[model samples]
Target: MSGYLFAILAAAACVAAFAGVYRARAIGAVATTGPLKAHSRPIYHGLNAAIWTAVPAFVVLLLWLAFQNSIIDQFVIGAVPGSETMESSARSLMTSEIRQVAAGNIFRQPTPEVQAAADHLRSLQAVSTYLLVAVTLAIAAIGAFLGMKVVSARYRARHSVETAVTIFMMFSSLVAIIITLGIIGSLVFEAMHFFAKVPVTEFIFGLRWEPQIAIRADQVAGQGAFGVLPVLYGTFLISGIAMLVAVPTGILSAIYLAEYAHPRFRAVVKPLLEILAGVPTVVYGFFAVLTVAPAIRAIGTAIGIPSSPNSALATGLVMGVMIIPFISSLSDDAFSAVPRAMRDGSLALGATKGETIRKVLLPAALPGIIGGVLLALSRAVGETMIVVMAAGLIAKITANPFDAVTTVTVQIVTLLIGDSEFDNPKTLAAFALGLVLFIVTLILNLIALRTVRKYREKY
Candidate 1:
């Protein structure tokens, strides 16, 4: 029914737009032959009418939808016998049952009063929807009339439309900012709970990464180690290995596609390369577990290297493959953003193509390339599934890529898995890890932004 209201509102807006256009055209018809016609175009007047007709109706519909269910639940509970004495939680559960029954999802026999309450709930909803439709349509019609009435030869509809657009853009940006703050606030709040029990220094600088807390006094683990260093070390090691594999290949491919490939070939190959990015991380995880892990283990065994079944090398390599498009696509855009004049002038100076690319184009695009690498590095750092499947679950300080090591993301998931008491450090530890990861990503983004500013300066 809400969707139907949207469709109706849209249709009314279209009709209103046409009416406004007709009214404006009629008003300006006499002045067309004169020096000054309408101050704003008929299209702007039409848009103004559409906005007036849709916005109030949309707002009313949203408010109605948001509040109607709660109102219904309150009224129905009050009307139902024996509901008044129930606890708040009981009332909530009863509300759920009533809604399920009203929605035709009844699993068992209901009392006569419940059946009647369901009927009452349905009837109220129907009446509310009908009233909503009537009220909104009336408002829209009045708005359309007012909008068209204002459409005179001297009216400034274009200014009004531009102001509305600017306001909308500001609102969108405000919403994004609020949501970002909310996420960071939540991470910090939960992380505070973690730090209350465990000292900050122990969590941050300690070398061990065992997060399991003993449930009983006699448990050999006692208070399990909460050191985050091993986890941080593994994360950086995997990310470092991934960056090593990704950087050269991605940048080279970008250079090839941007500078050397035929247009048609570039179009085809670039999309194919980007297709790798579209592949799910879980799918990559499966590929790592089934294919890459075994291959690495075989190579290690043949070369007299001791390799774990689940090795960081396999996870890092696959993760590198996954993020190739991030670097490649961004690098391509960066190279394309570089002035063709620079390339042409370098060639004019008798520099070879290779020399021109190395000395001229590469330097020009370096900032953007760095920005892309940093973004990709952040992406590689945050990835969970690939590392979860390919890399071993043990968090320990290790330099060998073939040795099993777990990352911060993996630890977060492991710590939070199954039933966990929120007050316990084991569960709270996830939030601490999350806060660290969030800070890392934030720093990366800031660096990326700084590089972008530098790139803009060059252009």
Candidate 2:
């Protein structure tokens, strides 16, 4: 049976077990009414039984599935002929072929020994599946029996259920932390490999970025530069331009919507403005490439100014438009969160609406506005498609917005594409870029948090 089918059966068994246990508990509670008063509700008893039936069985199933492939492969390798004489790479290839043959996805003629091993693998997998089903169902049955036996009037079913729920929540939170740690660890490991090949200082401070290097000793091309500053410069330049366009326009729009606009108008306008955020970044990229870039170039040329077909100006402008809704929505919420009593008191003190808003509402909302801007800035920095389509991939340090330049994210994407040789610096450089990007973003988040906390405390 398929793993998914097994999962369904396991779930069904748990449900059936829970239903029987709950019915028995409910009947028992009503039958006796003396010093043995029911300590917890029938629902809690049912929930506790369900948790016991499912959790252990699911945990075992997950662990078995995680290690099943590796164990099966090891057994298959031991049985395959000439396996001990094969190199690591050759063994990996053979394993792939065996899996393909076993699954009936074979693309090439297999030797008799390989075919025999494949058949054996299929048999092993079938037996393993049967064992998994039996074991999981047995566990669920045992847990359900124990749970039902313990469901007396004095049993703390609510406490047990609540404890299980608390543990599950903690596990869920830990998963996120584990995933973040895994990402950082992977990046640092691969980045260390990259730095072993290229100097860290050169990668950080050098002004050029050309990661393509000759693979063969006889090749004529020299080792390409791995400088990161030019890419960082381009990222900052474009993001700065985007912030310039997004911040004022979004804040003003938010101010109008939150403070001045009629409720009916706000209802109509807010969703319309937020629609920009829902539009895919790729769509913004296409707009920039097909329309904005061309228009900018033509206008620049007509005015006797130089402009690239794919320039920072085009990408930044489109990115700014894309980020506007994020800023506007967040800022609107921030502005709306200010106390109405404060607004009323300011007006009662003879201050004009505009003056009250400027002196009172803006100050109160500044932290949230700053937070929204920071978030918008992060979105602009991490953006890939819009920059890739509208900004040409040339790593150069220049202040001119009309010039073509590339970002760190674009470079990371380029370096990782179709390059499987992790031993090479060219592929590993992607991790180096990723690490730097993560650090920069972390710093931004820290600053934003600190600023928000300070203002929040003062307010």
Candidate 3:
């Protein structure tokens, strides 16, 4: 039934879009006679009409789809005797579970009330689909008819269409900005709640590292400790090690691509770098655990240094490999953004290519390069899978990269991965951690933007 409704909606949308296009083109052809005719071509006019016809109807269809399931479930729950005794949301869940069972997705038999509710829901769905299809088709047909009628000699279709398209583009850009602000707003609210429970000073400045809390009100071993020192230490350790591996390797690769490597080498290298980015982090995590950790351990033992099976070194090194493409790609763009004249001027003044690059190009691209590094660092800080799988989950405050350590992201994942009560502070703590991570990344991005702007002004 859902599939049938979707098919009808799709057909209606296509019809509306094609109708709008036809109307706009006919208007363009007729309206060319009068003085001050619109500048845009007939096809543009047609495209504008087609977009308008599709947009509103498709929006309506989406809204209908979103509400349909809830409305049907509510109706079914309301019909069932004693359903009102259950909480409204719980009743909805029960109804949905029964529906699943009735549809043969589950083996368990539902009670009489649940079975009745499921039957009612199926009936409601059938009725809703019929109504939705009727409404959508009616709207599409009306819109198409109106559009065809509006195509006349006096109508200025082209100008109107272009203006609408420009407005649409601006609106599209605003949606992205609005969504970013929304996420930040949500983060702020949760962080504020966390700060209320755990003092900001302790979270920010405490020296200890523990996140254990009593699950039951009576059982008490470790509770009320919210120190973040270990998590911060782990973050810095892993990030620092990653940078140590990534920076030199990435910079050399960028230099080769920009200054030394032939076009042939570059053609192969760029795609391979992109392929590195495409590889899933989970796959990299496996590689780190199976390959890198054992190798690091062997080397450590041979050199008379004790190394844990789950050391920061392994995770950090693998993370660095993951970040290499990010650094190299961004660095390549930064280098490319440096004007050719600057390098040519230095070389013409008797400087070697290396000297010119070192003195002129590097300085010019420094700000952008820093921005890229900060971006990569932000990613490292938030990275969960690599650290979770390779770096041990034990939160320990340590400076040694060869020791087991954990990060904020790892804790957040551990805290929220399984079933937990909604009201539990442990679960809520994940939101607080998320909020902190969001703010840190946001600040880093703003700093990078400012740095780049300053650099541009200088150059």
Candidate 4:
């Protein structure tokens, strides 16, 4: 049987078993009133039984699925004539071919050895399916029987169920934490390898970034520079421009919507504003390239100013437009969260509407506002599609918005594209760029968290 079919059968069996056990226990508790008065509800007894039946069977199923392929491959390899003499890579390739033949996905006719191995694989898979079904059902039945045996008045089924659920939740949380740690660990480890080849100082402080190393000895441009400052500068330059556009406009729009707009107008305007957030970044990239870039170039030419066809200004402007809804929606919530009483008090004390908003509501909502802006800044910094499509790939350390520039994310994408050898510095440098970006983003988040906490405590 397929895993999903088995899972469905197991779940149904557990449910039916739990229902029967719960009904019997409840009837028993009711019949013997004094000493056997139920300590927990019938639902708790049922849940406890269900958990016992499902958890163990699921764990066994998972372990089997995890190791089944490798175990079967080993058996297939041993059965194939002369397979033991093959190198590991050759064995792996043969194993893959056997699987392809078994699945009938082979592009060419298989040799007799491979055909024999494929037949054996199919037989093993058939046997394994029967065994999986038998073992899973047997374990579920045994677990259900044991769980039902313990169902009594003083069993504390509720406590047992709650503890199990709590443990499961903690495990789920730890899984997330471990996954995040794994990502960081991988990035750091690869980045360390990169740093060993290219000095940390040169990568961080050097001005040029030419990571194209020649694969052939006779190829020109063999020496590749690993400087990161140019990309970093471009990232900050674009992000800064985006924030400058987003912050004031979003905050003011939020303030107007929260404090002044009519209810109907607010309802309509809010969704329209938030719709910008839902639009894909790729769409924004197209807008930047087809519309914004040309307009800026035309205007710059008319005004006697030089503008690159692929300029930071065009990308940053479009990116800022994309981030507006993030800042506005979040800041709107923050502003709306400020108590009406505070606003009334400010007004009663002879403050103008604008003054009351500026001094009372905005100040009260500053923490959330700052948090929202920081989040928007992160969004702007991490944007890839817009930068890739609109901002040119030339990494230059210029403050002028009209100059072509690139970001760390864009460079990372460029470096890792196609079939890349991980050992090469060109590819490893992507991880190095990723590590720095991760660190920078982490630091920003830490600062935002600290600021939010301090102000939350004060408020």
Candidate 5:
């Protein structure tokens, strides 16, 4: 039903645009008898009319759709017998069941009262949808009439259309800002709840990271430690190892592709390299678990170094291989963006090819390369599936790459598994960890932006 509303809106906008052009053309025909003409093109007038026809009614339709479900739930739940006396959770469950029945998802027999309530709910929804369609179409008609009234010989339809488009673009850009704020707000909100139960100092500075607490208020359980250092160290350790593996390799490959390889070879190699990014992270995890981890363990045993089967080394190496394309693709573009004249001038000044690439080309492309590296670093920090599959569940501060360690994301997943009661510190800790991760990623992004702005070379 809601889908049909979108179709109707689109059809109405198209019709309004055509009708507006027709009206403008008619006005032009009348004006040909005098020394008057349209101030704007017929297309501009049509676009303005389409905006007028769609915007107001679309806004109303969205508001109606957003609130209609909750409003219907309130009315329908009241019709359910004993709903008034049920606890909030029970009432919510009953409401869900009623909705399921109304949506034709019932798999078992419903009680007579529930069946009756479902019927009533369906009836109300049908009436509401019909009313919505009528009101929306009526508002659209009124808007079309208003728009057509302004379409005359000397109307500034172009200005009106431009203003409307500018506002739409501004809103489109604001959507990202709005989403960022919403994410930060949600993390902070839930994190504050966690902090209320556990001290911020303890969570941030304490060394242990056990996160066990009572699942229910009446149950007694051990008060778990909320130290984040172990996971933080593990995150950095794995990311550091990944950077070690990825940076030199990725940058070298980028340099080769951009400066050394023939054009045909570069084209073939770059696409094959980028194909790594398209390979799913789960496949990388599987590779780490089945292939990489075992090889590392075998090598460790042969060399007298004890290593866990799920070592950080294995995880980091596979993660590095996974992000190789992200770095190579970006770095290749960056190196290629350095003007050809710069390289030619270096050669003309009696510099070797290696020296030109090393000193001149690298410095010119440094900003973009740094930006790519940092973004890849950010990617490494946020990865979870590979960590979950290959890294240990145990969180411990360790310097050894061969040690089994966990990350913030892995810990968050561990703590939030199954049906978690968010009131407990055990579950709430995940939000705090998430807040920490979010801050780290945000910092990386800020640094990348600053670096790009500070030294970005323009050719």
Candidate 6:
């Protein structure tokens, strides 16, 4: 029933958008009379109207939908007898049961104390949903009507709509900025708490990393080392291997695809490469563990090297393969963005194709290539699944690529896996690791940005 109502609302919105567009066009067509001309094409006025109708109502609907549940819960709780005496946790559970019951599904009845509260919640939800639907429809109608009214003689609808759109776009850009700030703030706050409990020097410089600190006195080995050296070493080692494999393979593939491959070949091959990116990391994890790790171990044994079954090489190699599409796609864009004039001039100078490409094309596209590599590197660093599957859980401080090693991401996952306390050093340490990873990626991105900017200026 709710779905039917939502579908009706959506269909109405679409019709309103189309009607607004058609009305704007009709008004523009009528207004092209003697001596009073509009600034834009009729279609532009129509599109302006449609956008005004859709965007604002779409935004309002989203905001309302997001907050409606909390509002309904508050109202329902207030209406129930003695509900003011209920604990927040009890209230939360009662609300969950209320939602299930409202959906016409049987839920385990709430405790006797909250039974009346649950019943109240169901009624509130129905009322809230009806009210939300009406309000949303009303807003959409208002926006569409206002847009239609403005589509007349002497009305600069195109300019007005464009100004509104620019403001909306600015707000959209701030969403990403706000999210990033929120993440950084959370990481910093948790990391500060972790550092307060465990000394900063010990966490940073100590050579060991055993984060098992028991809160109870009876537990054996209460205090554990918080050394990040092992994790950092493993992180660097795996990332180094990933870069080693990814850079050459990715750049070469990109060069071939962008510069050498025929259009038909590109059409077939590009989609295949993108498909590689689409494969989930967990699926890659299984492949890395089952296929790559074993293959590496077998090959190593045949040769002189004693490769650990959970070698960093296996994780890195698979991660590199996983990130190949990221690098290739970005590099292709970068190469494509290089100006034709530069390539033509080099070719005109009697330079061979290879010589022109090396001297002119690659240099012109170097910044983009570097940016792609950095972005791919960031992906590699943050990747958890491939490492978790192929790399050992034991954080070993080692330089050997053939040995078992663990990364910061893997450690973070382990620290907070299950049955964890936020205050426990083990769980808290994950935030610290997360913070370090964040900072490292931030630095790489900044460098990439600067490099790209420098190259753009030169070009």
- Candidate 1: clashing pairs of residues: none
lDDT of 3: 0.77
Q: Model 2 over residues 259-343: C-alpha lDDT tens digits?
A: 8899999999999999999999899999999999999999889988888999999999999999998889999999999989889
lDDT of 6 by residue, 1-459 (tens): 445655655675567557666776676677676577666665555666666566666777678778977887788667767767989998777677766665657656555545665577777767877786787667767777776677765677668767877998898899989998999999999999999899999998989988898778887787888999899899988888889888888888888988889999999998898798899999989998999999999988888787898999999998888888888888888889888888888888899878987887777788778878887888888888888888988887776677899889889988988988798777899999999888878787888888777665357
C-alpha lDDT of candidate 2 relative to the true structure? 0.88
| Model 6 vs. true fold: TM | 0.84
Once fitted onto the true fold, the runs of candidate 4 whose alpha carbons sit more than 4 angstroms away are 6-10, 17-25, 28-36, 78-87, 107-112, 345-352, 454-457
lDDT of 5 by residue, 109-162 (tens): 998988888999999999999999999999998988888889998999999999
Sequence-dependent TM-score of model 5: 0.89
lDDT tens string, model 4, 1-459?
556746774675568556846675666667476655667777777888888777788788888888999999999999998987999999999999999999999899899999999999999999998898888878888877777777777788889889999999999999999999999999999999999899999999999999978878988787688899999999999998899899999999999999899999999999999999999999999999999999988888888888899999999899999999989999999998898888889899999999998788877898879878988998998899999999989998986788789999999999999999899899999999999999999899898878777665234
Give the candidate number with the greatest TM-score.
Answer: 2
CA lDDT scores, all candidates in order: 0.90, 0.88, 0.77, 0.88, 0.90, 0.81
Model 3 per-residue lDDT tens digits across residues 276-390:
8788999999999999999988888888888889889999999999988888888888898988888888888999988988888887888768867886887789899989889
Show pairs that collide, candidate 6: none
Model 5: residues with Cα > 4 Å off, grouped in runs: 25-34, 74-120, 214-221, 449-459
CA lDDT, candidate 2, residue 43: 77
Stretches off by above 4 angstroms in model 6 are 1-6, 21-35, 38-60, 75-113, 213-215, 256-275, 278-287, 298-306, 350-354, 452-457
Off by over 4 Å in 2: 2-32, 215-220, 457-459
RMSD of 4: 2.7
Q: How far off is residue 233 in model 4, in Å?
A: 1.5
Tell me which residue pairs clash in candidate 4.
none
**How do the candidates rank by TM-score, highest first?**
2, 4, 5, 1, 3, 6
lDDT for 25 in candidate 2 is: 68
Question: Residue 327: error of model 2 in Å?
Answer: 1.0
Q: How accurate is candidate 4 locally (lDDT)?
A: 0.88
Residue 109 Cα positional deviation in candidate 2, in Å, after optimal superposition = 3.3
Higher-scoring candidate on lDDT, 1 or 6? 1
